[model samples]
Target chain A: MINNFHSLLTIMMTDPTNLLSLGWVDSFIIIVYFIFVLGIGYYLLRFTKTGEDFFMAGRKMTAWIAGLSFVAANLGSLELMGWAASAYQYGILATHWYWIGAIPAMLFLGIIMMPFYYISKTHSVPGYLKLRFGEGSSMLSAVSFGFMTVFMSGINMYSMAIVMKVVLGWDIHFSIWVSSITVMVYVVLGGLLSAIFNEVLQFMLIWLGALIIPIIGLIETGGWDGMVERISQNFPAGDYTHLWSTMGSFQDNPMGIHWTGIVFGLGLIISFAYWTTDFLVVQRVLSAKDLRSAKMAPIIGAGFKMMVPFIVILPGLLGLAVILPPLVGENQVSAMNPHSYNEVLPLMLARYAGPGLLGLGVTALIAGFMSGMAGNVSAFATVWTYDIYKPTHLKLSKKEESDAYYVKIGRWCTVLGVFVSIGTAYLVQQFASIMDYVQALFSFFVAPLFGTVILGMLWKRATAAGGFWGLFAGIGSSIGMWAWVKIYPGALKYIALSEHAKDMAENMYRALWSWLICVIVTVVVSYLTRPKADSELVGLVRGCTDIPSEGDLPLIKRPIFWASIVFAIFIVLNIIFW
Target chain B: MIENKGISIWFFIGSLLLIYGVAITIANVYEMISPSMEKQIVLRELNFGVWWGILLVIVGLIYFINFRPWKKGNNNKN
Candidate 1:
């Protein structure tokens, strides 16, 4: 049955026409999408009068709105294109980043961490650092995070340009300008509200657009069983089907990442850091209407997050099982091109989607790009205004400022942020893969930031000095590791299993080492430093903080109930896929 | 008034769905009426535009109705 589907795919591939090219109807659909997005921004502009409205949606978003936006902000071109490309390169092992890498951390955030964040009422993650660890730690966090967000926005811009250039044959520079301009106009005018609203809409469109490919592919290849059979037959050496079977040891996996790296490096450190701490994602949850909604947002996001692999990862597996054989033929060595693998999602869309749906799919891709850029830009603007600019520039000037003054500054910062992102996008051209670059950035910034935050929240003894130094040391160590690998590529052999393993699993080991260094530094420094008084630490540290009790809500509606359900499903998925 | 009523989010969502539906429907109909080889090929495969459009329009209408000031419920807080 799989062979029959393979033959059919081959016949389609033999056709002279490129499946990925955009037709008039498709372009029209994309145009309509843009117009609608701008229309929302214009309409919401009136409501965005106050800084709170612009920065945090006036703190009035329900669980559904905030939850959808929280997940959707993350469902950007990076998640769509980079992960699909990763799937093509690394097989089903890439799903680990989505499942074990995301679910538990999201649950931990909703159940354990949201109370601290929500009750504190801080505008950004760095704001929390300011309250807990004083000026030095907060400044370091704000500066690093400000720089990181702009860089991330630039990466999103670069990824969008690459996809457009490949799929629509658009000029890369032209694509970047159009997308950056579109994002800037809306974000500057309507602020985070516009971004979140578009994110919710994009979430719907993306599912509508991308879901069809895997469904059709599954039908063509005779379901999961057939896909597995076909993949093994075509490429027996490549372990593309199994997820955990390959994860027992570093040598056992196609990803060359051992269970320790997958569970500890990615699952604990990287995932926790991203979901709990990164303002790009956390900002949406922070905008929730109330405490209960805030707590429920990540839980809702986790439920949807666990299912994302089916849409994103399955296409790459299909590409491997069915599409790659015809294009590459039997001589896989000469046919190896990393660039071509990155085009898997676009190629699959071109193959499956016709005129109208084709438009929707392309529009969905653009939406993903725009939302990602907008999320980063908005987060940057907020952190800059409240955390950095407010304290440093505004305070020094000694001029009393109104809420509207900060809102104006937020708008200006949005413009500045997007411009910086455009510059960063050009810098990203030197990198081979966006995924590796993004992971490297996460290691440098997020790992240490999380270490500082976790210790501050759990251990009241963690002083201002410890927080600052621990974060500084963690970031410095990650940069050193990256430089060491670049200068002495053989350094990886000590940590990784083989030559291939060293290259593939470098980010995992770097994250592990950096996180270890951060924890050690923080613990030692905390013991030596003077701690904040118990009164000053109230509602900030875990033991001293009061956890909110569910009021009048039924058993099923409670956060604990939903978390259990999601975790049970998560465990079941791992077992089945194992 | 709309901001005070806290219906912007509802209206925004409704407008998005309605606009998407109308766009898809128009584009699909145009392809059907003045068909090119590309349009014919695309149409022949799986023209989900009209059906999905109609579904979205219905959903949009439901949301739009809920956005009416008279229909504002206890959860409507800005």
Candidate 2:
């Protein structure tokens, strides 16, 4: 065993840079965290007796727990590292992701979309399609979602392993195996219950552990103004500090996109598609105890999510202003230039945190990655069991399976999903470019799926044929656009409407076009095809469904009230940062 | 307080924070008492661990008390 471990370490230590040295105190904290999460899984195991319990946390999470989990599910290590890197590379413009790219979409999900999802009583987003459109669209979504989740989980795993290798000199294979096994054990044991509980915990850990970096950093840099001045001194050619002032043209900002792309592409299409349609996050809210909690979950999530930039972006800005040697981009990283933009967060942690605090910081990252893996695997298991396996096999077999049987399948599927993710991690390691493409593929379905789901919920005239064809067309066009750029690089100017447009701009515009195509196709096709009867659309469509009242609680107690307050803050934050 | 039966999630979060806080404070105190003759990180003299630990402990204690695992009924008021 010792010899094998040594060989594995030798083989997997690809990154020569080892930036962190954890003391015994730090190791203890990490060990304690691992043990505590596993304990929570075991403690919740008894409660996860039925399929509902396993898949939906017995539908009993409060708004606070579910809300935090909703945000935490998306707050993976990759997001933190990537956004911080973006901050270093693109300046305060990167904050657009957390603020404009996320807040409005999250509020929309809470105020507009939650009622449809909660009232429909669907197990998954694809399940909602099964109700609204038919089996064809549902199966397409389920199969695509299954592939996306597993691949995305693998990408998260690979990213975590790389971070560990770079920062702590841990073996990639060892990190992969240990994290996969831990996530598998907990999720298989307790399913979504374990995932949600751990997500909330991860959320707290991320805040506490990472909040120190910006705190110490701001103090060292003499506050926001000092940091901005230092950044300007370091690089005066670019407008990295201001948000909107530099967004008039693609050349004005480092991100190489106009305000229209930021507002329409990212803000409207990608954000709404993700926040409203992604089952990984929606599952958390679906587990809420009631409709009010369901609505409030995303509202509360938006409130906290708006604050994430402080820990993520501020640290990168601090690193740029205060660190002696500027960090290089990923392409520029080499033996001579050892520091990459992605290393900013870990580097900040190493610089600012003492031994014990360092351990906590590392734990926070581990928790983030693990929660992300759990979120993906659990969602995959749900879709696979409910939308894929049951529909394709069980219904055909005509077997009356027990709820416990389905729960057992969910457990086994979670294991299978983790194993598949491990395989994908190895696959990603072999071809680095596949990781980028796989991540892009995850988004290819989002905008189109959002179009179909939103249309099905709001428009009773949308036919089943229109829904499936529209989704198919949108997904096809998105992939076609991506291929157009890849095959003909010059086409990007046409697609993004500027020669200065970059990959980020390409993504936003792609989502926008795909969503528009989906809507147009659905509208055109619905006019040609036979529409579903209004009677048939009873509980699913807006005009036919009688929306449930969330109670005449005092004005302050309503979700819309809180949502309004959060939206006001969102607007205020944009202006302040602008 | 998922399902209002198991331990409150707040209590669980608080307990973890309190333990980490206490451990960090102890380590901070130990390091301060016997300064190591090595290069230190930024703001080591500021005793960030001590103060951050204390803050975490105080907040953790508040959550722990309000939604104590020992008191089942005082949870999930939302």
Candidate 3:
């Protein structure tokens, strides 16, 4: 499962037929792109100050910048490649995950969890937990956040490498190396600031390329009506038509994925944990200019989440229905056995996109992949340096060099993270549903952090002992059940284990179960322990409101941010007929 | 300090309405317009330099733009 997952990840990394296929124009275009990316990173480096600058982009991100960064982080190289693969493999049902899963989840997270965001204004989500619950809880969350990164970064990079090998005809190692080396160059140069700047560009660029293939495909096939007609004729409209159905012959079809699965099961749990609790989203909102900016960033993200179905999921199925028939046989469409649909979307892009614009599209995808890698590298470095390094080791009397050193080491850590994660990606390649594997592993850590942090802020009664024990209980049961589900496939296979099926241990990790168990353990532990001091809760609340007032918000952004989000939401509503 | 409450509230509402309106407009326009009409345009302009394509190219160019680390008057960084 892992090997197949890795192999299929790069299905869209490059075009197999275009091997050694460097045109003068393509070469020029590619060179220009490289110059711009490196240049942007270099320029953004100026924004780096003390450790905060390197780690949190100086906590000065505008809503526009945050929106772009969120979008970029939302997609990695694997996502750019995977959407095509998913669409081709599952028809339109791939989109349902975006609309049903991503859009509503992020929206609810923004509104429902605003109170939590208001209180825990720290660098990483674990840091917020620590602030809320005490040192022990924060430390626990930091460790879990670190673990989650290992799981997610590995899955993402590995999948991207798979696409490069399949699409670009590069050796798997070479793909991994090239991807790592290039992304590291900029990520190391500027840290999170560089990561965000580069990602904004990437988000726009990838979308440009991503949306292009479908429009062109639609043209080649006839149009939207043509697509629907072809889908109706060639495939069951039910499979291709619906966004929330369980279709696809590649893996186990778990029972927990029904309406209950979509809503109460995997959907509810992941949405609550990830949107409300996960530090990645939290980090972006925290970086906002103010409370208004913070709220705006997520609202915008929710809006874009809605468009993803149209932008990502529909194109792949359309590839299978409209474009893939003549160029590649069904055998080739299925690709090398176990039917690796991952590469088909990119392959279809190569097959369909006119040769003139092909280079730009390819370049855009490369940008998208690198941007995601950069986000992980930067994020991991931030947590390691801030939560682990500075807190643990040498203290500088002068804040300047200490800050400068953080800037320096933060960049170095990103480089280290890129290299380590690439290696980790290779290891993660053993799983099948690479995306699911990453998410499930994330869920294990995500929900516990959510539970601990929320309680830490709202309930002064939350205890450090409770925080530690709760984390252990939540994460421990997640991993344990994962092992059980993997070996047995017996009663609990219904879990899909949601994300675990995609990881190194294919078919465990059940996101919902992990969250439930984690919350239960955390609450029970908190209940068992002494209540937290009142002063600590007050401090956490004060910190949340303090920074946003003077530093970032200038009144101008307030309107722009709100406007952008409202627009984004409208886009969401129209796409899924929601 | 800069309490232009009226302006701030107006901008907030205006920005929200515009952004949301645009997002909804594009989506709605796409739906309202015949898919066949879109198909005709998309097919005719496979290689034609549409504004969308041009805009995409321009956006890519912006990513590559190089600025000196300490350019004379770039206050945005601070």
By lDDT, the best candidate is 2
lDDT of 1 by residue, A1-578 (tens): 43443243234333333436555556566776777788778877988999999999888887888888899988876678778878887888899988999999999998888888888888889999999998898988898889878887787788787767656656678779878898898888889988898888788788877886787778778899998898888788878877788877767766667787788878988889889999899999999988888989999999998988988999888877777543331234253532367778877776666656777887778888888888999999999999999998756998768999999999999999999999888877876576466657655888888888988888888988888889889899989988887788887775444455645477777777777788889889989988989889877889878877797789978998999999999999999988
Q: How do the residues B1-78 of candidate 2 rate in per-residue lDDT, one tens digit apiece?
A: 566566777788889888888988888888888866663889888989889888889988888898886675764442
Identify the runs in model 1 with alpha carbons over 4 angstroms from their true place.
A1-19, A324-339, A429-442, A495-500, B1-4, B8-10, B22-78
What are the C-alpha RMSDs, in order, of all predicted structures?
5.9, 2.6, 9.3
Q: Quote the positional error of residue A205 for candidate 1 in Å.
A: 1.2
Query: What docking grade applies to model 2?
Result: medium
lDDT of 3 by residue, A1-578 (tens): 32333344344335545322332333444455566667766755555656766777666676666765776676776665676665665456455456555665565544445545644557776676656665666676776676667557767767666665555665677667766787788777766766776676666557655676666677666877788777777655344555443523324332223445555543566566666666655565666655565656676776666666666776676766654342332366443342346556555555544332454567667777787677667777878777777666644433334567777777777777776787677666665576566676666676556556555555566677777777777778777776676687663545553332433223223555666666677678777877655555664643333323323657555534454565566555535442
lDDT of 2 at A25: 68
Which 10-residue span in candidate 3 chain A carries the lowest summed lDDT? A247-256
- DockQ of every candidate: 0.30, 0.68, 0.07
On a 0 to 100 scale, what is the lDDT of residue A143 in model 1?
A: 89
- Fnat, model by model in order, equals 0.27, 0.71, 0.05
Which parts of model 3 are misplaced by more than 4 Å?
Answer: A1-22, A112-120, A244-256, A324-340, A394-401, A425-443, A493-509, A539-578, B1-46, B49-78
DockQ of 1: 0.30
lDDT of 1 by residue, B2-72 (tens): 22444556666666677666766777666656665743332244455566667778887886676654564
Q: Against the true structure, candidate 3 has what lDDT?
A: 0.58
Q: Is the docking of candidate 1 incorrect, acceptable, medium or high quality?
A: acceptable
Clashing pairs in 2: none
